[model samples]
Target: MGLLLKEVEVLVVGGGNAGFSAAISAAESGAKRVMLIDACPEHWAGGNSYFTAGAFRTVYHGLDGLLPIVNNVDKAMVKKIDMKAYTADDFTQDIHRICSGRSDPELSQILVHESNAAVKWLAKHGVRFQLPFNRQAYEVDGRFKFWGGLSLKTQDGGKGLIEDLRRAANTLGIHVVFSTAAKRLGVDARIGSVRSVFVQTADGIEQEIRATAVILAAGGFEANSRMRAQYLGPNWDLAKVRGTPYNTGTCLEMAIRDASAKQAGNWSGCHSVAWDAHAPPHEGDRLISNEFTKSGYPLGLMVNTEGDRFVDEGVDLRNYTYAIFGKAILAQPGHTAFQVWDSQMIPWLRDEEYREGRVERIIASSLSGLAQKCAKHGLTNPGKFVETIAEYNEAAVAFQRENPSKKWDPGVRDGLSTQSKTKRLSLAKSNWAVPLIKGPFMAVKVTCGVTFTFGGLAVDPKTAGVISSTSNSVIPGLYCAGEMLGGLFYGNYPGGSGLTSGSVFGRRAGKAAAAASKTWNEDIQLLSRL
Candidate 1:
């Protein structure tokens, strides 16, 4: 086939939240021609964004501040809800704490400070927001108390988020072409600036599309087994994917290989979680989506094949710990673990992930019976499992007796722990420690589900322009956002922060690209006059 050519003021590669954000922002910022290309077909248009819970961790002024943008709460519901303000400092602390202070200071500050404005911009483009009642809040004392520092989500989660973004893009007249994969970044040798992109269509035809500016928001290499094994190390090739199969890091590779983009952030780290062991290994189920996540470990206990507890399950709230716990599970024997909860705590498990039919559950009336049932599913030592429960129960009961005032409140760090001055176990449940006395016990098998990779290109925090690895400077007309633009996260990630980071930088990249495109046009006109 002949090399087909096209021209646009701005070209965006990737169709997830970040790409859509950039396309919309570019169009709104006065770029007349903005085109977005996705490697997947129209059916797989949203990339990983479609599989998200659509939760966005942004700085908000509590209930009154978020009410103006959210659509789910009524006056009665609002009266029953208690939410605290999440300030820029709070957001910054969460990022730093979760990432172990390895997050880039400049990038994190930009993300934290611009988060509220980014969400507001998304809402202005018709994306609906709502309080995350089911995921981030718990009912206590006839009221819904929000916790985890995450209060907002899209109305229908990721599906709704993508739909709204697509609607806004179409309304803004941004051209979207599916089944087009970006293969290379075409740079002008004379100017050392991005001037074109070589792409491949579905029919095996290659084309070079010239553009004044290009924005890369094509996500990470989570879905690529080869790349995952290469960067994330041993057995990552076997980790189940939690999102799109299309995010194979094509555009990210193109930027690095062709534009000499500097790589940044944690190459070995990723956002993973305790997913249903039975879920698909290579790709995420669009219908089931985020339901595969098993985040209720904080409300219960997790045990490996040896029936021994490995990590402190209640060390922190689920938001802060869930992302890293998946790696812990993967490191265990058989790369699997059982999340055990009694009838008393089962009711609190979110229906989206733990409902009766959502995942296979093993139930038993006694702890011994539960252990025996788990043995059939790879629990190597039933006797040790029963013993572990007994020891944990004794520690928990003794701690409760020592500190009677400490209440077990899942909504806060209530100080209900399994460690006491006189009596302590090898490992302790730091908070919400309740003895496993109530039975009709239930357990679900879980394995690691890789969400997104943390390693990506380095960019200017202010402009979101990709930095050249050789020159240590911005690659003039090349910009990036979302998972492709890293340095914001390291060892772990705070829940709901990925989507927020995407929008925060996507907006910046888009606005800057549009302005740069306009300048390029002006320079061309001046040269023509000369």
Candidate 2:
């Protein structure tokens, strides 16, 4: 069965972090009858956020500044930790640096300047950020030090993030319609604005929900195979998806068709990771989606099926470089790569990789034994594998001998050279290239798993209004945010910027829509009649 609301003051599409933020902001801004519509059913309704660690990258003044975000942390305990403050300049520089200065200037600027404010807003609305777990911090001399410009993790990770956002929406009495998919948007030609959307209900009935304004925060088109093949180029459809299957970009398509929107950002660029090769094609099991990611590549060596090393795994931190490596793996012969680690490196693997006993890994006590194990699983013969390891080990030994005093620093590249050795690899391992001489080596196979798409309808930065390509102006009564609003990132992206961007722009778009729709009553009576 379907139910139609005669006239909604605002219609925010999607139900993930962005959509929830938009609805909460609209209702807070005094918009009446604000409703959020999502295509997903209630249980699996947080979109991609449901499967994330909810790491938010922001600017803070060391430990004192971090106190606000990590409210649950005891001040006494925080004082014992050595925290480095990431300045606004540091944040922006990283945004530019990681993407090779290809990210949009204005969007990156806003994200840097307004990131703190956005986090504060989320906190005000009951989003609690807990002290980071094992990933971004390390203890030295009995004092914990934070690294990689990341210090806070959401209290409940992604699920908790969604719950807190939705709880805030409910407290504000924001209406949410689940299991309803937006089919098409109806535009008033005279005003050049979206007035209503035709939605298909859960029971397959068509319903129209007229609204004063529409905020599209329904995420990107990464889930649609044909769209992925068309926009992301050939073989992209073959890559595994790491998040929701519901984000087909239908809202983005409709917005572009009606709003004269220009596409922006690197459409082919995405936040991809080196997920487990044996994992399902899509987000099948929550446990697999959560713990299946094998991110210990920088700590060891990864080789394609040709038994050859390709990328310099230690050029940058895993978070900064992980997004692009998946594409490299996708380009490999079998679209697969193996992350090989020795006994010494095994202790350094991420906690999830160690805790999750389900990972199908090859284990052995010696290089030759490990080679035999890998050969059994189709990574080429044992001889070639051992030869490759010996060469890699020689380079690592030479580098170690040259820099005898150097220590393993995960925060920045230590310039650990794999070039000065007797055998030089074609593609260099610039940093963290130590000898894999320890016994009991282990390896995990990985393939490309895309997180989200980077391209969508371009918008005005200040108002987050969907921009008109023809007039170079905002489309009245139309707004877009979250992953659907592009022009923010390119070439590559910062590790934890997705959720922060979504919240910042989603809140802005919501408040903008509420203020813009204050006088929009022209079609209320007409929409009511229909």
Candidate 3:
């Protein structure tokens, strides 16, 4: 017995950042009824945005204009990094570079142009931000920095933003259902359009939801190892190590199983593998710190089972991490890299609880404690570890002494500190240094934990509908945005672009769906009357 599901003007499947925007945008655009259905099993509390250091990259905002040096160095460092330096030519070039020519140019253009307004819209929705400051080069412009505009991650602020959006949806009479997970897209075979969606509620009651349009913003599958191996290659270990727990690639299965869908760009998946061995459940210090220069934290040398410092530890984070990941792929057992840091980094670790996101720290009082931490984590012998630390320290001391006036970037600078503050402590006084190094040491195992899967469904910008590559026509009533839509990221993702792209495309999709709803309502109502 088939149940005649209740109908809505628009159906958004997911409750994270993107889905929230999609439902809100649809209601704001005059949709008679908008419904956002999410499993939110525990709560969509920690998706990519929560774990991620929230950033959005766009070209028109003038971030590129401010720090051309950072822009130039970024270009020099990585040839394929997407550079949307506000110039149409540069933006297009970056898009092509990142996409590797596997994207719809028209859709890419629309994303670039609308990003600025998308950010502003977030602010309008009560997602307040810190005062903007100039950082490195921005997405398209040089003015967009991490501080440009971002809501503080307060319980009131973060939850309040979502509540405000939900309230707005309620005022417009949009249906917002919690604990409802979209099982799959219901496609009408007779007309070849999205008819409804299958949902499973908290009590395990399976229900159907009929809609005029289905916007699939259910996120990607970074947590699924089988999918990771399928898309990323045979060697890729898709561990549930990082990113969101709900992102098990269920959405990707929905797309692949459907015969009508066409997959799109695979963004820069070949980046670093981020795994936190000391992460939660069993471990206390859940800080999976990265040894990247851009991460703004000092990193000691990273070694494989062979105990060799492979790449330049002081290079740009992406460059160093990419190199390490490559080495990790070849290393014994593969996908595991040992991060060796001294007690000097303890301050950063202790203060981590107050900070948001992943923070891992392991304490030890003696050499035996250090060895035990390594042994417990399945690390190789700590014998070479001591030698590696000493060599690096010696090199750092020499480098800092020779380069006194150079106010160097933290990541690129040799691990030695010539800064007046660090100089006062001196390597002799530091516990992690050679003579005093008999005490505490820490190491974390890393694999590739992701913020969101960069890949997603393909769509046309003009209509916000899934496009058929063979026919070049819109897949009627099937739309996507946020991490669910692919090709917005070309090569390297600009910091804030992920959230910004979600907002931009979500609004565009909402407006289009609202306009299309009129025809849908009349047809459905006629069918009901009959």
Candidate 4:
């Protein structure tokens, strides 16, 4: 005979940020028995959240200059972003515009309304955060005034948050198991309700976990190349760069295999920022931080295979990233777009800590030395590359001179969608207005990369219950949140929204699941009596 199964009021799959918040919310929502499971040995370590700069854009009372600029959205929902700018209406409109009207309006409303509550809940659990005193240049309207996002300080920051949630869960008598992997989800055949979860323990023993409600918070499949190729087809190469090494999409696979789950949203091969992982300076090359979206000296200048500048140099890094990615797609398979900079930019890169440890002095010595460095990196012909730098410097000097008022604004306004007019003009010109006439330029190849695939299973707004698009019915007790749920974000991703979405939806899923568990229990009792 088969062994008897364990039982719980709620079962949460995956222990990343979404899973962590969901587990805690479920326990707090009055689930008598809750069990959270993760495949990681201890807890998830170094997931994408830890790598994030931890910026959150909100409309609150005190903050003024850190939120995104939302020009209009009378019909859209908006909320507190900061004190000075971005009212609730503005926030909702900005998000809705990004969504392009396809997102579930109910979920969007919940996200806007519950985001602050989620922040409060996180703070109550001991997550530390600071208000935005200064907004990044890209956040033109300052929505992030009153409340800012939290940054984790721990060996494994992602795991640290999970640990914090675990403690909160423990205090509420919730059960958490590490080194346990769910093998398959149990679903009732008649109504397609999730019946239980089957998992393999560390000792290689199979066990069944019965739950009245189940939440599948399993993350995106960025790490699974096979799935990426299958789902994305020609764009499979975009998934080569792994967002989280452990996110192999096993649960996503299981969901797709079952008849209950359906796909949502279209795949947008969003552009990604690049860092030379192998030859970075001492700190380890990541994205250039200090020089990002600020001044001109360390600004990014993208060039095509023929060493010609493309796109506006002064565009926001995130938006500029997409343009550069387009250039990469046009380049020969092995030849991608490259960023060329001078030795003078190294100090800014080093100070920001984003450049890792490489310094400007070390990057360039004399004209000849820079050329040799380029040759070593296989960027271009040493002599040709050096000459290109000198030419660019001359042009830069000339360009600056032609514009008498160098401090003049670029005149960007809302609804200006033309790409040609957005091209960056020179900030400083030479005596007679020439281009770059200096030497010792450095070049690094860049390719189009992706962080995570945003497409996945569809879910309802409030309950986060998994739904079948064909049948237009909810799989009674199944739920999903975080990167696992698609259609929440489409076409573009606004800053600070990813983490907020996960927290907001995860909590809703947990609370709704806990309530469903009780309803299921009562239904069973009534049936028994009948």
Count the clashes in each prediction. 0, 0, 34, 49
The TM-score that candidate 4 achieves is: 0.75
Error of 3 at 7 (Å): 0.7
Runs in model 4 deviating more than 4 A are 1-5, 43-47, 64-84, 96-106, 131-163, 233-242, 268-271, 279-298, 304-306, 310-313, 317-337, 343-347, 350-362, 365-371, 381-399, 406-449
Model 3 misplaced regions, further than 4 Å: 1-5, 42-47, 58-109, 131-164, 202-206, 235-238, 267-273, 280-298, 310-313, 317-334, 342-350, 353-376, 394-405, 411-447, 490-492, 522-530
* Candidate ordering by TM-score (highest first): 1, 2, 4, 3
TM-score of 2: 0.95
CA deviation > 4 Å runs, candidate 2: 1-4, 421-423, 521-530
State the lDDT at 306 in candidate 1: 91
TM-score per prediction, in order, is 0.98, 0.95, 0.71, 0.75
Error of 3 at 316 (Å): 2.5
RMSD of each: 1.7, 2.7, 9.1, 7.8
Which digits, one per residue and each the tens of the lDDT, describe model 2 over residues 108-203? Answer: 899898888988899999999976757777665677767788877788678789989988988887788789999888888887777898899889
Q: Give me the displacement of residue 476 in model 1, in angstroms.
A: 1.5
Error of 2 at 454 (Å): 0.8
C-alpha local distance difference test of each model: 0.92, 0.82, 0.54, 0.56
lDDT of 1 by residue, 499-521 (tens): 99999999999999999999999
